[model samples]
Target: MSPSELMPIGVFARRCGLTSSALRFYADSGLLPPAEVDPVSGYRFYGAEQLTRATALRQLREIAMPLPGVEAVLAAEAGEASRLVDAHVAKIVGDASAALRKAADVMSSLGGAPALPIAALKGPVLADAVEQVLTATAHDPSLPVLGALRVEADLEAVTLTATDRYRLSTRTLVPSAPPGRTWAGTVSGDDLRTAACHIRRSALVRLEAGPHGIWFRTTGREDRYARLLTEEFPDHRLVLDSLGTVTGRATVSKEPFLRALEEQPGERVELRLSGRAVEVRPAGGRHPGIALPATTTGAPLRVRFELTTLHPAVSTAIGPDVMLDLRGHDQPVTIRSADRGDLTTLAMPVNPSHGPRR
Candidate 1:
């Protein structure tokens, strides 16, 4: 193409709703490079076709996707691109919720007395257990305690619990030694995740808690610490008991089920379970549906759920097959790993009148 066909950086930036400097920065970061560069004047130019990539870059950056993630999305195919963007949005929302809860706890402790010393627990097993329940930690600011991982240890095992009011997860691990006395407290979800990440680098991880703060350390590495959220965790055992008897049950392969859901177009989908197969389609529509084989043993049922809320829980399920424990359309749906009883996720269905659950 001739010089007339190539758009100057300034013109291209204006057309793409971006600043000239931003285009330059994106080019330097390899997110959106210029189509051409003048050897003498250092002027940059872009072809008309480059606008699609430029627009995508701007939109991805606006959503706070990291440069590396943006590059991955830009390199992906159409289907993969949507999946990457969805995952990024979910992470940002989760982090924002945790931050709000942490800020609230900090503000409330301004004039409180010093905290008591917390006992120390060391081992990768404990760290793994804490990480498991962190997935269910509450991200909503309204319920600050649920934003924390409840840590309880006795002589035999360490238990971790987290809930977001909508769902709950509990994990237990056998500890190397039992504390002489029980040690229980709530720690920020963000802090627990950081600890879990660091613990993986060492053979043994040590956890120490005090009235003012909590600390996690691995030999030859920098220790991590944060203020513990003193709020009381709800009686989660009672919540678990209230899950009610399962009225319907189905065990389906995770990969196929997840793929079908991903291919579905909308943010909500209706799940219809028949004798031995489940049909998934866009909520309130008949076309664009897929059926997958399942081991079902209950009455045929139809339920609608927000895909955003249901997808993550299934994506993180432990094994090849996930078991669904259903009560009714209006009730919360319980999902578990068919192989292990340790992991459980509960997702509340979308109320018919209110549309999708936020």
Candidate 2:
């Protein structure tokens, strides 16, 4: 190859987004040796053809991939390389979660706060409730509490609730053992999500609330900690109390209801309830609606909702059949299992005037 085809270390480092020292270190480590080295001058030169590999190496290092992992990724095929990167990321995330839990423990110890026993619950049941209710949490920079799950525990039951303004989901779990005392706090949703996998496998989980966080002491697995948020959770109980009486009710098979919603076109959807069926349609009359069989009572109603807000509320119901209690088009619709009342979701509907985006 011509001399012009090779770039000196300084120029090659600039092109590959790596410093000259980094290039020298990698070359010394046998990871990215230069294309050519001048014997007399003792200088390194990289060919233009090596730029792709150099760039990939830089990216892998940017993600904090260890040297061995980076080397493996650089040598692997495209699909294998992608999988390796994903595995590295998962490991980093798991490590970070463990670090945060350790930090929380350290802080509690430093502050000399005792861990107060909160409640003991079945691990599988707690895990299920966390997954279902956390669907209502939203991540917003301004209101961090919206991304938290409220834990309220008493002697009989522990209730988990989350709301993203548009939708609210709540699940009540009867503890295997009574709580030491009544307790309520907003626990970080992210932390709970990280700990959910371990929580699911354990036979039992004892919740202990500390001054700064909550600890999930499992029967056989590693204990996990969830930081407690100081922000005030939204007054969901007020909304529940203020709700008007249900004027229309419908019970439909969960599968068909979800399918109808999935097949419905546009971002905004309309539901017309009359007789023993509920019709799902695009908001702007662009397509004919599909009717699903339902058990109906009370007055007929026409309601509108953003597909984003409504689908999750119905899909998260616990049982095969879902019941919708509609007060009015303007009111929030109550969705829950037709047979079991433990899990309930409230979805706010859009105005009838809202139409599909142009």
Candidate 3:
């Protein structure tokens, strides 16, 4: 038998969030064959070590990826599924945003400008969600509750977006699926920014929205959502997309890269934009080429980059590595680890003068 992580069928079922019968179904279908079968008692045994892979399989199922597709993704080297996930998030975010804009325009025409309370805004984003909002709001503070913002939740996720315009950042939701599927809600961007500071990651939030001001009261908490003008936010998508010039590969530690971008007194490096390597020389030093596990079919690439703009790209990593997408360059390059979620940083190339060129 192939060496594999195994667990008893019953124990594995609870961890995988699948029923024993369903596991048997997987084995029957040859989707996930168990390690061994008990001859005497007619029972199944799964390797405990396979739990992570099994759980990943279930998550893919939750997202509705087909069985064959799911198997293909899992069977590939790690991070393949994560890349698929990032692509999915981008596509969905775009489609959902369009639907939301249409819904807002309709609401405006009907005379009911939406008002999303601070409470409603707080619930949509999960851990590090506050950090997510703060990244965009760092330059501006003191958000006021506008009341007519938008909030939405589809089966797999939820979203909070405000269109005060100069900038818009949407907090994409993952499945928390607590008690309130019925608690579908919305809130202004300002309310969200202001309130994120006090919102508890573990508490259930109750929302009350009206023409006056929205109220976000938790069952046993003392938190209030922050409401700020969406107008103050720069068109972050555009801003983020338009940043930096020249693109190339730079290998660095995920932890250091994260801190360098996220912490104050941000790391300053003299960007020596070369054709291939975008060398990330720290203020005090230079590190070796960060050899990473990867899956790609290309020549060893080196390039130059605009050091200033790489920070935001690095800090926003939901995973580990950055998918450095370089347009406007001699050739566009996308880099990441062998596994999908392994990359957390993403960089986009800009025109020489810090503006987007097409």
Candidate 4:
């Protein structure tokens, strides 16, 4: 055959039926670079060699392998490349299976029928209530809810919580949870994790609490039943405070907090409460305290929050404002949420009780 025509980016996009944006993305990702770029104009040009790579990349992406992963496969040695491709194929198969399972459940719900494995839940309406609370309440995997529930509506709401000692779970039937009187539940401290495992296929999910467990059931399956747990659960509320009472809301620079702890672990980050601003100063004031550039509203209470407890939560805080509610001295500070549900209500003892006594 005669030599194939060398294609430019525009020609490659047209022939491949892809978009210019996609071509640029591939080029930037190290998967395919243009043959040349006009020095002054900076216009990208492509050669035929890249077409092969582009075609293969499109196929790999179709198989659900991400761009970075594709690069790994391409760069890997012969034997290693084979193993990587095998792993990629296995992931694709597993992902497809999961997708099918979800589709089937959706169809079943749409048909107004109970999803399969309905027998997995067998208990009482009380179980449904526990499922509601344990499902709604903030959860920490370090603490899990070992309970079940039954419902009697097309929707319900539940709160789930655990205390290494006991678990408390409750549900609300305000037309939010499942229609039936029963469902299973789990608890976790991670939202991304909760979405993956729990909260599968259903509408109206208010992540008012921590993520831990999940309950899967068909929509409009009201006659459903649930198993019950007749055990006492520790009162997390008593151990914790309400979210509204949180008056302290300060915006601190996250970078310095990391540096302070790195300089000296176990040292407290002193937060001096004045009017509406709390200066986050390092212990002993060796490193000058950094006044939060932002604003806040709360009681003028001077407190020292542990760097260990504060750092991790602040690092993972959803947005700019790290709202801290320190109402009770010994109570855990409530980490305010500006999103769907409460992000974290961390129980922190009053910082002053353990004074700076070295």
Give the candidate number with the greatest lDDT: 2
Which candidate, 1 or 2, has the higher lDDT? 2
lDDT computed for candidate 1 = 0.78
Better of 1 and 2 by TM-score: 2
Clashing residue pairs for model 2: none
In model 4, the runs with Cα more than 4 Å from the true position are 1-179, 182-233, 240-267, 338-341, 353-358
Best by TM-score: 2
Residue 129, model 1: lDDT of 65
Q: State each candidate's clash count.
A: 4, 0, 45, 53
TM-score of each: 0.63, 0.83, 0.40, 0.39
Superposed model 1: Cα runs more than 4 Å off: 1-132, 178-180, 356-358
Q: Report the C-alpha lDDT of model 1 over 1-358, residue by residue, as the tens digit.
A: 7899999999999999899999999999888888889999999999999999999898999999999999999999999999999999989876865675466457446755543333345556566666666767667777788788887767666677888765677766654455445688788887667557666766665556556556665689866665678677888888778876789988999999999999998888889998999888899876768999998878898888878767877877778999999998878788889998767778778877887554
Ranking by lDDT: 2, 1, 4, 3
lDDT by residue (193-252, candidate 4, tens digit) is 223333333333332111222333434431211222333344556645443466566554
The CA lDDT at 306 in model 3 is 37
Task: Report the C-alpha lDDT of model 3 over 241-357, residue by residue, as the tens digit.
Answer: 655553334443455544543433323432232433333344334443323333222234433333444554455445554445443342323334324432222333334444432
Cα-lDDT of candidate 2: 0.91
